[model samples]
Target: MRPPAPRRTTALLAGLGLLLAGCTTAGDDAGPGESGLLTGPGITETTISLGALTDLTGPYAALSTSIINAQQLAVDEINADGGICGRSLQMVVRDHGYDVQQALGAYTEIAPSVAAMPQLLGSPMLAALLDDLAADQMLTFPQSWDSTLLGRPEIQVPGNTYDVDMINAVDYLLRSSLVAEGDAIGHVFFENEYGENALSGSTFAAEREGLTIVEQRVMPTDQDMSAQVTALREAGVTAVLFSAGPAQTASFVGVAAASGWEVPVIGSTPAYASQLLETAAAPALEGLFVMVSGAPAASSDIPGVRELVESYQSAYPGESIDGGVLSGYGVMEFLAEALRIACDQGDLSRAGIIAAHRTQGLVEGDLGMAMDFSDPNRPPSFDSYLLRPEVGADGGLVEIESASRAPAVDDYTFPTSG
Candidate 1:
């Protein structure tokens, strides 16, 4: 089915309008007034500082950089428009190098210095810091979409979890007749929360679609997936769903091709990395599909998306806009809504921001869909777009289908162990 002409959802228009409004003279330049309420740390009379603990020099460095850039763009724009509640929004970033101990140390050092943390990069690292964060009632914008984070009110993941992505991917395959009922479907996962989250969805789909799921788990450090691909092929699987990193993605596709195991390969969001397109495995990745929660950066039909693309292009001329960049931009939009609501309530503190997030039920912006925070424990959206890879001068993953929402996803319970 063809996707309808992209409608400028109210959320999209409102998000851009709010950002543009910041550029106008609408907010109170006097900043949040002294209400004597215990606002969280990091808010001064003139500025609201946000901390970002990232993986700048780690395995996921490229992704971390994109997110940082997007967040910076939002901050710059917000600051130019007079900032939130009359105070400049500043982000204090720390690179943890994807090490849990370093991440904990970074959080310890910066915990007392910010009003909120809008970017906590690693799942394991974030998990290690959760206790400390909760003790201080600190609000965080985590990068991982693991369902476990949903239980923490202070941690808000901007997009759906890996489980939701798999559910939709499976549904797409079945609906499109690429796979039949009872066909053997294999899953190559990382064996961690990120991988398991995706497996949970695929498992759910299998139970509903009557497909057999052959599981193959790998460690986060595993770079070669030849053995796994060989096993899946022997099992006579009709397709493979992946929940691993970029290197693993390349390895799986390249190795599969070398072994002559041709099957539709679908990956969760984290499985995609534009950098893979430049690798020796690039040719092997042709025709591979991945799930994307938001509209791609290439889709300029939405006004907010257009603004983001233009901003990124001008700022980083010639740089590729990938999912990481798009995700980072989305995060800021989510933060902006929460901050705006808090400022309106005359409380720019950490507690104030949390309260604002809970009350700001549905926020429509350029992020993806209208995000609803009415229940922080639930996913913001269960739908996704299916993207297929095309190599060469005009190569990139193009959206072949939009608005693919699976019933299995909608019915799947949150915080399930896989």
Candidate 2:
């Protein structure tokens, strides 16, 4: 289906409404006047629409729900601030159930109404939509940080990839003396691109530190990892790097605890879900370390993070915020910045947005890291936040900082392929 005519739609909106510019009222001239920059399917004289593709009813729902809430919070704030280029932002959200086919269908339906997709939930979903997004010239902000997603012209990753994250994790462990020179490091990861990327990093780091790397691969469908834990235990691995989902992570930890093996376990960001604290494995997760591309929600050092947490508390008093919410907030904040830059460049269209992205040298994100989206292939940040799960006052995983390994891991190039 073809999108509506940009000029006709802009004219219709302008003819139907006129208020104060930037005054929350629409026609008044309190801010920048209408610069006639509305020239896209989802852009109008006073509004710009963004789409959010999420997993609201599948394995990742717990994380995606918080992400959606935080994204809406960002949209609300953008609208309240009189919008960008005198245009209020609107989010068109859809649940994909973490299915590729469903995500493809949902994308087709919402593509015409959105200038860009600021949030696409999973690595698999993004993979399915890559061709369509490229053909349409739509800018995509994918949630996954896979190394293979790099070099795509239309896709933007907000943080370090799993590969770099693992490198940082290994570097931290070695430097902190959690593992010594001759000790073996075990890696348990999904038998897919995500795990492959993570293993690449660990392998590289292991080679550098003269440590042996032992790997255990599992299918995504497999839930129990007692066998793998047994293998690692027998291998005498001093530290374990996990690149699996929350359930798999819990399985590894729980199985290890049951077997009375107490080696240090480190995981990628997705490995630690807030839901884990409620599971039967909650006790086993204590002191588990995970690496995050962004800062924890509890970190009040970043002004944007502090404001987001405070707002979340007031807006959803009954609900609790977590790391997922912070990740979502960071992504949206990056999108908002890109939109503003596009508006400044006088090209809110898809092509214009991509062009503006290249010119954007450095974007300071609320994720506690600065991003550089000028190159599509390169990750925005190589820095990672090392977090240890502790029982917070709320009885959930409170991510406490362990180390910052950016200085050591910064120069390491993420492998091109998984």
Candidate 3:
């Protein structure tokens, strides 16, 4: 069972204020006077520093690059608009290269200086640092969406968890008649929290729909999917659910096509990369589908989405755009809201920031869904958009279904942090 939520008592606040006061000298600028905003490590008189622990040189480089760029764009815009709480927002980024060890080292180096982290990528990395993060009371938005990371006040998942997305994927497949009762389904996944969490959903769906799941677990370092595909083909699966990185996606699709296994392939959001459209696997991706939390980056229907896309295109003329841009920008918007609320209460300290975040009842932003941040134990949103790969479409994906939550999600039990 999870522990009780931390109380924001006057004594707790006072202690944190005193501790922070000693950290910043009196020569520093005054706090926001009206609210008695007590300044903390990342908050000075003129700037509020946030940390970004991202993957820039590893398997997720392409997506992480786009995410970081979007975050930078958000920061620039926030600063341009006279900043937040009379102070400019500064994002300090460190590349973890998708390695757990490197991620830990980067967090250690930056945790002392930043008040909060708006972007920390990778499930394994976040799991490794979960205890420390709680101890530090660092409000973090992890790029990973595993259910096991839930029930922690300091860690906020930006969108639906992997299990929730998988449940939705299964629901969509069943509703579309891609798979039927008693049909075998192949589940290709990594041997980690990410894949395991997704597997939980698939298993639940299979039980509900009278289907069988043929599970094939692979490590992140495993790229070739020949063996897995052959096994799935032997199992005579009518549909496939994949929860892995882009490399595995490309390989799995390519091998399936070569083997003449013409089944509908559905993957989690991180499973596809825009660069794959330029590869031999591009043709094979025609049978591929993905479940994501946000709309396409170039979507123009929503006013907020359109504005972000226009600003991004104008600011970065030649850079490629993807759904990561939406995620990066949206997370920053979420963080900025918490900061603004904290500033209003005159408490920029770490504990104060966490306290402020809990008060955000319904956070409506340019993102696809309305997030309820009031309950930190629950996921922010449980909706997903189903998209398919297209050769020339923006972000190499075309939305087949808008954002919607599956009925099964209402019965799904989310895992608590251990």
TM-scores for the candidates: 0.88, 0.87, 0.90
Predicted model with the maximum lDDT: 3
The 10-residue segment with the lowest total lDDT in model 1: 1-10
- Give the per-residue lDDT digits (tens) of candidate 1, residues 1-418: 1111122222222343233223212121223345532244777777888999999999899888888987888788778877876788899999999999999888889888787788998878977888787766677888887876786767787777788888888888898788999798999998887888888888988998899899999998888888998899999999899888888889999988877777888987778777778878877887555544544534535566666767877887777777777677777777776777666655655656666666656666654466666566787666687776665321156666865588777678877321
lDDT tens readout by residue for model 3, 239-305: 9999988899999999988877787889988888878988999999966555454344345366677
The residue ranges of model 2 lying beyond 4 angstroms of the native Cα positions read 1-38, 297-301, 393-403, 406-411
- Single out the weakest 10-residue window by summed lDDT for candidate 3: 1-10
Clashes of each: 5, 8, 1
Between the candidate structures 1 and 3, which one is better when assessed by lDDT? 3
Residue 387, candidate 2: alpha-carbon lDDT: 66
lDDT of 2 by residue, 65-147 (tens): 88888788878877777777788989999999999999989998998878888789888888788878887878888878888
| lDDT, ranked from best to worst | 3, 1, 2
Q: Kindly report which residue stretches of model 1 are placed more than 4 angstroms away from their true locations once superposed.
A: 1-38, 292-300, 391-395, 416-418
For model 3 the TM-score comes to 0.90
